[model samples]
Target: AKDNRIRFYTIGLGANQMQVDSILGPITVNAPDDLDEKILEKLANESGGMFFRAKSAKDLTRVYEKINQLEPVKIDQTYLQPKTPLYPWLLAAAFVLLLIIRVIQWR
Candidate 1:
């Protein structure tokens, strides 16, 4: 981790809970279109972050205001992920299917 300092921000626009699940995990919201509340929750839960939604050009100004109001902070995250052989398996499956098709044609 060079410098060991980074900030991660997740933005969900007109997105349901499932869309944000992999990024933010489980979260409950009343409406998918409401950006204010969703951004608010994300900021609050993610270490005093900033939140805003742009419903229009005027709303864009408000979003900027929210960002300006938040104090500077950093978030550090680390996780373990395992790798599996994917491409080789797919190639093997395709090879088997081609062989089956060739045999069928010969029948």
Candidate 2:
């Protein structure tokens, strides 16, 4: 990614263990045990990016906002020219020319 100038922003969510109420009773299970935070951190570090942990929706929103602030999109404003309607002027000119032609024909 360094050669291609690509960045990676990694995010890990939820906890490793979760509890659920079952008919038998309360059971403890693995929630995001498959998610390896160390791999994510290594990837972010290698790609020159950031690693974020979001436990809830609010934290995810904040992480997104921080990423936006860190790397804001750049738009080219050089080609922003205001558009002027030429059809209106062309229609007026055509009407004036038609009126003049009719006046000459009548005379």
Candidate 3:
């Protein structure tokens, strides 16, 4: 990624343990411990990015918002111009055509 100038933002979600409900009752089991946060953090650091830990949906939303704010997209305004409205002109043309048709029919 460094050679290509690409950055990585890593996110780790959930806690060490999670609760699940079964026929027996509510049970607490170990969460997925296979997620190596150290590697995620290292990748973020090496790629000049950030590592975020989100325990809930709200935390994940906040992390996404933070990343969006950090890397904002720039738009070129020079190519933008005000829209030219042609509706009124088209309406007038239609009115004139209707009048001409009405006069021809009357005659």
Candidate 4:
């Protein structure tokens, strides 16, 4: 938590900044009551990240969206995706299998 190399994002559900400050400092185990702003702010501050607060469900979603906007994951779709058309081959195989089953049943 004290390391600065890693980045941490914290979301406080109901606790305000002041309340968060009071609860966080240096603790081995955090109680459930202080699990809100205190823990999140501490982790974020120590790791050079941000601490966001959300009081309600809507606010929570908004905070999460903001986090995503801030730090977006990069996906390399060009090389990671297959170039061949697999669906047509799969459909043709399935049709052939079904035709074979039908032929066997007729015999």
TM-score per prediction, in order, is: 0.27, 0.58, 0.62, 0.48
Write model 2 residue lDDT over 39-100, tens digit each, in one string.
Answer: 99999999999999987789899999999998899987787679999999999999999999
lDDT of 1: 0.57
Those runs of model 1 whose alpha carbons end farther than 4 Å from true positions after fitting are 1-44, 72-107
TM-score of the candidate numbered 1? 0.27
The C-alpha local distance difference test score for the whole of candidate 2 amounts to: 0.90
Ranked by lDDT, the better of candidates 3 and 4 is 3
- Worst 10-residue lDDT window for candidate 3 reads 72-81
Off by over 4 Å in 3: 74-107
Q: Write the per-residue lDDT of candidate 1 for residues 1-69, one digit (tens) a residue.
A: 113333333333443433225466856654555456765666545653434445445656666665655
Residue 8 lDDT, candidate 4, scale 0-100: 87
Candidates 1 and 2 compared: the better one by lDDT is 2
Q: Report the error of model 4 at residue 77, Å.
A: 1.0
The global C-alpha lDDT for each of the candidates, from Candidate 1 onward, is 0.57, 0.90, 0.91, 0.76
Tens digit per residue, CA lDDT, model 3, 1-107: 96787889999999777788999999998887788899999999999899999977899999999999988878777876789999999999999999999999999
Decide which is better by TM-score, 1 or 4: 4
Specify the poorest-scoring 10-residue window by lDDT in model 1.
1-10
User: Over the stretch 1-107, how does candidate 4's per-residue lDDT look in tens digits?
Assistant: 44536678888765333223435564343335665567778778888889987766788999889989988999867766658878999999999999999999999
